[model samples]
Target: MKIRCSTFLNCHLLLFRLYFLSLLVFTFATTPEEDPSVIVSRFQKYLQINTAQPHPNYYEAADFILSQANSLSLHSQTLEFVEGKPTLLLKWPGSNPNLPSILLNSHTDVVPSEPHKWAHPPFDAHLDPNGDIYARGSQDMKCVGMQYLEAIRRLKASGFQPIRTVYLSFVPDEEIGGHDGAEKFADSDIFNKMNVGIVVDEGLASPNENYRVFYAERCPWWLVIKATGAPGHGAKLYDNTAMENLLKSIESVRRFRAAQFDLVKAGLKAEGEVTSVNMVFLKAGTPSPTGFVMNLQPSEAEAGFDIRVPPTADQESLEKRIAEEWAPASRNMTFTFKQKVSVHDKFGKPILTAADSSNPWWTLLEGAVKKANGKLGKPEIFPASTDARYFRKRGLPAIGFSPMANTPILLHDHNEFLNQAEYLKGIDMYESIIKAYASYVEHTRDGASREEL
Candidate 1:
């Protein structure tokens, strides 16, 4: 026998209520206990602050950085080239003021998060029973910034003084582009005055035991290809309609993307070694109050793509290929570049920090990591861009390292977290690296101390 309609409706309503109740429980059930470690408490406090894009609370974040700097007895300054965007700089001056300084940089702003998708409030900085502290910026880099300061605090407490100056830079607008953050700071007189020699920025975590490092990053190219042709009625088949040419160009670009992906799948290329092209959006058709006009064909259509090219690829050659194939003039197609490439110097060499033995910075960084009981994997070009590129372009050796091993890579993902123990361990590793770099003796003369030489 079939159930009555009223009974079926009542049952469905009951099921819906139960599902919602369970969801609420799952989202807010885990309440974390208070952490005793000063560093852990500070990390939690930082995650509670909102510095995400579009409208980050820059002043409040700067206050936090300033407090940490003052407590550690480090001199600090907050600089803003573009009105509200502030980049905080903290300095620990060494005995030798003339020596090139060490810069440890981290972006303050984080990406947006969806609270409904999280196990805890994304901004609460909740530490669960298992020691995982959940928050939005737990890994995308507030964690590293805190580690840098805490490491210095501990070192100074133990009566250690560096031979060279060390600077901690907390910047903004990295999620969009560094136009307002690092890009401006890198070009500023304050940065040049520091005479930066070696730099360290955030890197991705390693799921395995080995840590990941980056010496280069893929270049991002945002393009829009527009096609123009004769406009006519929808009934007749035209020789070269706007949509037809646009589709042809899209297909051509897709084929190139497929070939690049094939190389990755065949193990001949890593994901960072190949080009990635993806369609972001398309614009066409005339709009009526209800919808697009179906009876008439439009004269213009355009498609947008976000492409990333590896440094190994020749930039000039790729531009020529795009002009020849993707948006050829013979096909009545033209393209616009939303962003351009300029990661090279007057000498025509790509702006990449050498990871080999020839570079003294690289050798020193490798030694520091090993001394911390960390194993670093072979350096790879960062699959995405970072502010480190700005320093490398300025001829300074900037290494991308996060010191997070045996952890999952969860940047910008829902339920992002960092293990409390792991967070503390990162401070220790940073301590080793900072001490090594600050007291480094590149080539001291006989009987000459690091500071004297």
Candidate 2:
């Protein structure tokens, strides 16, 4: 009696698969939503903690976040490079262990803000009569950090474990280019072992009622141009002097700037367009006893340009123009160029969420935003670099998103704030986004045929 054991094994496999599917469906059936007031309070608490950049109060802010994670019974860790600068990381487990992961990331450090310059003290976290929260990091990012914590807390409280693990990363130095912060963290094994599939980072406010999600950002390259020419007397007529070459370079750069400015003003490119080049710093000659000497013919002159180029712009073309047009005269003068020091030695690769990529995360995000009582506005990619660039370079689909409606942008400026209505609404908005993403992954994740795992 050679009974076929293969038949019995096949039957067992079928039962196991059916049971697993049933469990997944059951998990998806019960996902809890967060409260709006609770969300606002959490945000206020975060804003009260002063985490200013350069000398960020990491201990105070990281402690507050860790305490909330502890209340949720999440195993959170505080990672610090220097003694006072700290970063917080929280992890929530999932049902299907083999599934990919998601990361909710925000920076703790805010740029230094003057209290007198603002309507309310930058660290006061004051809620105005109209319910507007006035603070430094209020709109720039503390809102996102608070929203992430609130959503995760409510989700965990409702006994809703995700299908894919969720990791919350709170970093420092994002305002200063993230060298001691996001860039360093990205290089660590912690993120590598997590195998993140998606990342959500901070972005700008929505001038309209709907939120904006950024899929791509232009790389920022700071170039310093040094020109040296003949050191002739002030009375002598100098043709190819340092000042002459420097002025020529500035004029050439100005021409490019004017073109970009016109393109931006005409609305040729969408929001977050890469069309601006700001000359942030300039230096020339030696400082006189009273002030800068005007009549002296300085031997050497240097200037710095903050250049933001779109991914479509060819670097070689621009470099050639600068070298040829701005190059110093030979025999009498010399030219030198250098890149400004940044946290990441090299610029991150420009990323784009392919229109035909396997994951239609953007489409799903749009639907989620609409469901949250906001109309689906246009999805514009960011034109400046961000921490989102770090995750995208690692092959994770990263989106720079923020939920602040009808608000003027004051990022990196004085008097930053967020209205109470917008802040609370943001909580509702993120809830919809997270729920929609989770449900989609749970139900239709299998619909997309499994690729080479």
Candidate 3:
């Protein structure tokens, strides 16, 4: 009787052990903890969401981001300064709340993608055998947004706590200009309450092994020039015809554009250092059933130009030139500017962040990248505008950075993609960066902190 009782207990014990072992195997096979695959999976999931502009599903994206925050035990909230456009914020509170916080900002909305032009469906987030994840926001920004959250997850799992709070902001409408998104938020009481010190925003990808950083960005100026004059037969040569006046203005603009392009082509200046003007549209003549009237010259003609000006450029001089040479009113031409971003802060200071050691934040950032085994290229002005300008205009230090080395600049381009390896490496890079920034407690002279400087 004793032997039978012992045998029954031993058999049940063996059966329980087998069941536990199988459970462990299944867990490992299905869910990985702190694995690169898991990180990539999260990134791909975000890329799958269609947040392309003109009609972005902001609520869905907000819900997805909030879910991630909940998984990480982060404090999350959504604020819509403009109805239907939601801005998401996640916070990892630090031990010391008095210290100024670090803000990592990324936009949810991406430029529209041409689905038929892509090798894979732009919203599919397809990962090929070579480990390239192709999608609409693969490079432009969604990658950065996911990287920020994943880095925080790893930090939390490792029992790491920061001295200063770190905030992740996923705002909308950046691709179409942040008027309803960051622009409003930056000026809101909520942003002021965050006590943000330094903001890190989006930057273009690098074509080489060194990552590119932007200290400033070129401001965009969308210009439309209209000319009105006497209408006449197409064959008749008139002194002040609308088309002729518009053509003269175009020639002036072309000359200026060529000069800027030549400087860049000759390597005398970086593309962002000089003014860039491109003719985007030209409208003239009277439309008919099939085409414009060929025999009669229309009295009015208009041309639109997309112009980018560097902060260091003379804005007043450029405007004067526009009024005189490019679209002189004496020539029956009038011009208007739209979406002209200011190149200076409210205090009249240039919208630029110091990249050298004079700024302690820059020093910390440089050291952090080095610790991650990454190299930074010489800081340059961003060739295009980004949401960073909004923060910079408020006299805050903003850095434009995207950790994508040895990759093509494919933002808003067809077949856009980011290799899984690079994407994983970026997460690692952000982990180090967040740690350095959050742990820093240095204070500068004049009672200002390292971030305030």
Best by lDDT: 3
lDDT of 3 at 222: 97
Query: What's model 2's overall lDDT?
Result: 0.73
Pick by TM-score: which candidate is best?
3
Output the worst ten-in-a-row residue range by lDDT, candidate 1: 444-453
- Give the per-residue lDDT digits (tens) of candidate 2, residues 1-453: 235687788889999999999999878866645456666777888998888866777888888988888888877888876456677889877666566666789999888877777877898888888787888899879898888777666566566667767788999888888877787788788767876666789878877776676766666767777777767777788877787778777888888888888877898876356545778777787688989777778877777877766555566776676667655445233444444222221334345544224556666777777888876456566766678867665545677888888988877778788998887777767777776655545323344432201
Listed in order, each prediction's TM-score against the native is 0.88, 0.85, 0.91
Over the stretch 1-453, how does candidate 3's per-residue lDDT look in tens digits?
A: 899999999999999999999999777655345667877888888888889889998888898899999999999989999999999988999898888889999999999988999999999999999999999999999999998998888888767899999999999999888999999989999999998888999888998999898989999999999999989998888898999999999999999999999999999999989999999999999999989889999999999999999999998999999999989989999999877877788879777888887777788889999999999999999999999999989888899989999899999899999999999889888999999999998762346743354
Shift of residue 70 alpha carbon in model 3, Å: 0.6
The whole-model lDDT of each prediction reads: 0.86, 0.73, 0.90
Instruction: List pairs with backbone clashes in candidate 1.
Output: none
Q: In candidate 3, how many Å is residue 11 off?
A: 42
Tens digits of per-residue lDDT for model 1, 1-453? 256888899999999999999989866754343244766999888888899878888899999889989988899998999999999999999888677788999999999999999999999999999999999999999999999998898788667899989999999999998889999999999998987878899898889888899888888899999999999998989978899999998999999999999999999988888888999999999899999999888999999999888778888887887898888988898999898656574345676777887766677788988898888998988888899988877766778998788889999999999999888878888998999889986643343322221
Off by over 4 Å in 3: 1-33, 444-446, 449-453
Q: What lDDT score goes with residue 322 in model 3?
A: 97
Q: Which candidate, 1 or 2, has the higher TM-score?
A: 1
Better of 2 and 3 by TM-score: 3
Mark the regions of model 1 whose C-alpha exceeds 4 Å error after superposition.
Answer: 1-36, 443-453
Error of 3 at 105 (Å): 0.2
